[model samples]
Target: MSERITRLEEQVAYLTKTVEDLSDVIARQDRELDQIKRRTQMLMEREAQRDLDEGGSVPLADQKPPHW
Candidate 1:
């Protein structure tokens, strides 16, 4: 009985540590995702600016009518 309890306790401790480790990993991944999102947004904005500089315009079908 005592031996079984000890083993179970050990397992619980290991599981707790594993959960904490996974939580840290998730946090890191979240930070990385945020960084990637920010970088992607910056790149999109830069591309939009480049397009504007080159007189790039949306198609007439895609844009609102001149009356608007």
Candidate 2:
């Protein structure tokens, strides 16, 4: 009976360690995901601003130079 208790204790310790390692890995992945999300949002906003700066619309053909 004592040997069985010892085995159970060892198993519990191993499982606890595994859970801690997995938790650390999950936290790292969450940080990486947050960074990617922020970067993507920044790039999208930059592109939108560029479009707005370019008048946000195209002109007619007659508006072109006489080179046509």
Candidate 3:
């Protein structure tokens, strides 16, 4: 009975450590995703401003594909 209890304690400790490690990973990823979202929003706003500045003069990149 003591051996079984020891095994359970060891297993619980291992699972606790794994859960903490995974939690840390998730928090880091959340921060990175927020950074990416901000950068993408900034780029989109800049593109919109550029388009407004170049009204009626679409750049080559702004053109449709040949398949269109």
TM-score of 1: 0.83
lDDT of 2 by residue, 1-68 (tens): 99999999999999999999999999999999999999998997777778668877433432567785
Candidate 1: lDDT over CA atoms?
Answer: 0.89
lDDT of each: 0.89, 0.85, 0.89
Worst lDDT window (10 residues) for model 3? Answer: 54-63
RMSD of 2: 9.5
lDDT of 3 by residue, 1-68 (tens): 99999999999999999999999999999999999999998997688779879784555676798999
Of the candidates shown, which would achieve the greatest TM-score relative to the real structure? 1
Clashes of 2: 0
Candidate 1 per-residue lDDT over residues 1-68, each given as its tens digit: 99999999999999999999999999999999999999998997787778778999753545798789
* Poorest 10 consecutive residues by lDDT, candidate 2: 57-66
Q: Could you tell which candidate, 1 or 2, scores higher by lDDT?
A: 1
Q: Pairing residues by index, what is the TM-score of model 2?
A: 0.76
